[model samples]
Target chain A: MARSTYTLTIPSSTRFLEDARQFVETHAQEAEFADTAVEQFKIAVDEACTNIIEHAYKGNEDHHIDITIIIDTDRFTVRIRDEGESFDPTSYKEPNLMELAKKRRAGGFGVHIMRRLMDRVEYRTRGNVNEVRLTKFRNAEHRRNGDQA
Target chain B: MSNFSVGFRSSNSIKVLDLQGELDAHTASELEAAIQKCQDEQHYHIIVNGRNLQYISSAGLGVFMAYIEEVREQGGDIKIAALQPKVFNVFDLLGFPMLFDIVETEEEALSKFHDAHEEG
Candidate 1:
């Protein structure tokens, strides 16, 4: 199978999230992913980008977010790079649904949604750049069978 | 930019908000402000009509999460109705149905509100 990659860069602003989402969706479709999987990828990327814009850039519209998506036979990966403050995704705890319902907390749901939709999520900071990568397997059953081989 | 808008109305004492276009992190604040207006007026029984809404991100879902407890605490509830399947999937993915009253039509939501209010 041939490997394919696509890259997009947009200002770190909420206004550009729709464009970003469409970009991811288009590439995911081109890779022949299922419609449901494509939608999950779009949502996962949107949440990741939104967090970079809101938390990393602190809502600064001037910074830029670089997104790269690579599609292979087995899986697809989305890498987001932002020049902003570093954030440790591992340290963030999933909010308790019962407690959140009772408290009605306004934020903290973005990361949870991203984690639930994607198969893998990783975060790292390289000097001034913050990088977040999300991955989804094309065929979970196939991958599981292959792992046994 | 995504074309997003929110309109407000009242039906039988239930506040209804008609949303259109995309609701993401950027456009979520508009919906937030609209909900805030409803809260300020002490209108707790609310129904959000999402039939026209095309897309929604987690941020959009968070807006409802933000206000639900307070609204419920005031002896009212926030019910979502008429959501397109695609839009509803976002909420469903996050287990929103467990936390919200989502129905197939705005009428159902309004009726639910009225029934609860009458019973109480």
Candidate 2:
């Protein structure tokens, strides 16, 4: 069962990504997640926010991003909402590594990294807001150890 | 705010950059400027020392992708060395090892440049 929820709101700007990452790291640690898991969540959240700022908002700094983190005993979920352009995340494709290397592509890596780091990633658009939800499950053994500690 | 800074050095003809702190969207431009400075100077042989790089995002990784082709076309390459495991995982996940030469030490990267120069 989900025990608590934390929310943060920040401008749709790249400058706030570090703050967002720190927020996730602190909460993940308090939840007794492993260091590697914390790092993965940090990267995953950062990539998601970056995509919102750069692609969804089209580099507009005046927009805002609302982040909600839900914590359960064995899982962590993050929902990011932005009032930017509506786009289908399912349509986006991870660049082919072989082609990326041959052409030396500079972008299109953010979505790929986000998907790889999180256990589940889903996106939807409701009305004028676009939401991206990411979830990561804690290891069963690790959670049992954390419960004892 | 996340901190990021770059230090430049020269190993003979090779330009070595020591990256410190976080490399994300906010600070990626700083790296881009440093790479531009290298291009302006025509110092194509480049090595990025990531021993002090604590964190990196895709934006930071993009900076390297932006200039690699130009440097390689000029008969030089950008090699990364001493990447902290966390940083390396990001690159490795993206299959960057096949695209760029990532070594265990800065000395190894510098030596590879020397070897390539001698062969050509």
Candidate 3:
């Protein structure tokens, strides 16, 4: 159960990604999360939003990305909800770095970064909305291994 | 706010780009345009100085990936230098260190260009 939950909504545009990251940074810092965890959460949220703007909304910039920050006794989570296109998790493949560079591709790295930084990354379809939930836990094992990524 | 910009600094034949402010999806296009301009002007040996770069996302990294092959194929390289630890961590997270010439100082990046020139 969450002890506290905060929400932020931004226009579905890449220009607003920094605001989303700043919101995460302030709340995560106030929560006294470890520095590494705070950084991870920020990047994860940014990537999630970037994916939504580019892939989900397809750069339409007319939609909204609803962000909910859930802080519990044991975990900190960022749930990003968007009304854009639904993502197919099964289609996600870990990108080959060299292959992408060789092909002159500039994307296909955001989801991978989100999955590595957060302890859990979940996708859900509720009615017409699409949500990608990213969570990082407070634990000794996590603290020890989280930095490995 | 996005608030990102790139400034150009030239050292001999090398073009050094000073990157500042947040770098994400919208602002990444600015970086891409700067690089594109460099390519257009036939300046291929490039160094990105990120001392003032406050943040980055995968879209920002993607710009580098998109330009790297073309730059290298032209017998030039993109050397990244002086990134803030946090900014560099994003690059590291995506395994950029292996595919990029990342150095701790602008001098090192410049020296790399010098070394290549001397080798020629």
- Per DockQ, the best of the predicted structures is 3
TM-score of 2: 0.93
Local lDDT at B99 for model 1: 87
Clashing pairs in 1: none
The per-candidate count of clashes, in order, stands at 0, 0, 0
Model 3 steric clash total: 0
lDDT of 3 by residue, B1-120 (tens): 449999999998899999999888889899999999999999999999999998888888999999999999999999999999988988998899999999999999999899999998
Q: What is the C-alpha lDDT of each candidate?
A: 0.87, 0.89, 0.91
lDDT of 1 by residue, A60-147 (tens): 8999999999888889999999988889876899776667777777678788888777878888888898899888887776442244
Identify the leading candidate in terms of lDDT: 3
Candidate 3 lDDT by residue in tens digits, A1-149: 54999999999987788789889999999889988888889899999998888888998988999999999988888999998889998899999999999899888898899887888899999988999999887875663235554
Q: Give every collision pair in model 2.
A: none
Worst 10 residues of 1 chain B by lDDT: B110-119
- Model 1 superposed RMSD (Cα): 2.5
Q: What DockQ does every candidate get?
A: 0.68, 0.69, 0.87
Candidate 2 lDDT by residue in tens digits, B19-111:
999999999999999999999999999999999999999889988888888899999899999999999999998898988899999999988
User: Of models 1 and 3, which has the larger TM-score?
Assistant: 3
List runs of model 1 lying over 4 Å from the truth. A142-149
Winning candidate number (TM-score) = 3
Query: For model 2, what is the C-alpha lDDT against the true structure?
Result: 0.89
Q: How far is candidate 3 from the true structure (C-alpha RMSD, Å)?
A: 2.3
